[model samples]
Target: MSTLPQIEPTGATGEVAELLAEVKKNMGAVPNLVKVMAGSPALLKGWLALSGALSDGVLAPAIRERLAIATAEFNSCEYCLSAHTYVAAKVAKVEATELEAARDAKSADPRAAALLALSDAIIRGHGKVDRTVLADARTAGVTDGEIIEIVGNLALNILTNYLNNVADTDNEWPLVKPRTHS
Candidate 1:
């Protein structure tokens, strides 16, 4: 039900084709979001570069996925929620309960819990988390490097969330239905 068409890697030409190939090679498939983003070659390349750059950041894969899940949940992006949930469980090896906790923006680990709380505060405060929250995160063992990476991860997830929302990106991964709170 996406407003944009998903481009098949084989059908793409030039840079787009090259980028799609790399994506497939790395991801084992061209996710629907990437396909839709292929409509803008620059976006496709930039997204890939940003994602690649973050792969070696201070944060662990599980932590990154956790942040992604929480951010996606906050944004109500079903596509991202579904995709990251799959990534978290399969690629990152996050526990099922941890995955659920991430989607709820809560973590059992003390440091992770502090970081998640800060993430929520940032989201709710429109990226202006108060001084006390940041200090609390530092006290919880979140280093400066990790804090920077956390912000980067948040920005990345927000970009994907916005793209999925605007494009109505179709889910190509196992579907993760949004949590309903009555």
Candidate 2:
């Protein structure tokens, strides 16, 4: 059987565990991705720190999660889609059906559908978003700064999704409802 590629740790000692402990201080549990990537506590810590900052940033919770889930889905990273979908439901309290539909559709909230479509556009590439798309996005309430932030958010998801896919990180904990879906 084939397996995923993972960068093994040369040596992980109490330090890795300490990083886990630190992460737990903020979050009740260090997510499985963090644990596996903890193969290098520094790497794990960096990802967690950056993730934490983005998550806690000025962006609205729903918006951040919308971008994350959309990116994960477009990338076809099942693991990431599951993980972020759960966070969106649990931490962000976003409705599950809505999140699911948003992941599958270009525009989640039809009202902001045009602006919302930008996440997918970033994943596909700038070409997917032309002058007309920009105009539509603006009409849908997206701003220049938000467009830039959306790119950053999608880039972040691409990083984490690729990392998780490579690690084939075990689903150490249960995901949110309907856990088994693709």
Candidate 3:
């Protein structure tokens, strides 16, 4: 059950129909989050636009998926956790152990670990991270552009996480429960 109505692709019309069509074309299905977001076509459009732009960002797909997993876990948004976990594993080819590690804002790779740490700090600190966090990420070889993209990815994940939390969006992907409540 969801607090918000999940707009059915079959019933959509005009801009909403076109947007849903695009989502389906790209993803092969209309995810519940996107369907719920379709309640506001503008919001759905904004999400699609940002997502498209971020796909061209310097961060690799695996890193982006890991960030989404970490953010979803932090927010205790089961919908996003499940969705991202599916994509991380099936599409990004992230290892099972790495997916679990991401839930704790951790990674085996030093560079990824640094970014996860920064993401955790940003979420916990509400964007006012300590200087040492930035220093650590730089020490791990994260460039300024990477840092900016990290923030952008975090923002994108947060939007979906918060939306699902508020909507109590039903999980359409394989369920991946959050280990802790935020």
Q: Evaluated with TM-score, which candidate comes out highest?
A: 3
Model 1 lowest lDDT segment of ten: 173-182
Top-scoring candidate (lDDT): 3
lDDT of each: 0.88, 0.67, 0.93
Which wins on TM-score, candidate 1 or candidate 2? 1
- What tens-digit string does per-residue lDDT give for candidate 2 at 78-140? 667777777778888888677876675444566435545767665676436677777877887
The alpha-carbon deviation from the true structure for residue 153 of candidate 1, after best TM-score superposition, in angstroms, is 0.7
Give candidate 2's error at residue 138 in angstroms: 1.7
Candidate 3, residue 53: CA error in Å?
0.6
Segments in model 1 whose C-alpha atoms lie over 4 Å from true places: 180-182
TM-scores for every candidate against the unseen true structure: 0.95, 0.77, 0.98
The residue-level lDDT of candidate 1 at 31 comes to 89
Clashing pairs in 2: none
Tens-digit lDDT track of model 1 for 1-182: 99989999979999889889999999888989999999999988888888888988888899899999999988889999999999999999999999999987899999778878888888878889889988999999889898787888888889999999889998878888777421
- Residue-by-residue lDDT tens digits, candidate 3, 39-152: 999999999999999999999999999999999999999999999999999999999999999999999998889888998898899889888889988988989998899889
lDDT of 2 at 59: 63
Alpha carbon lDDT at 172, candidate 3: 81
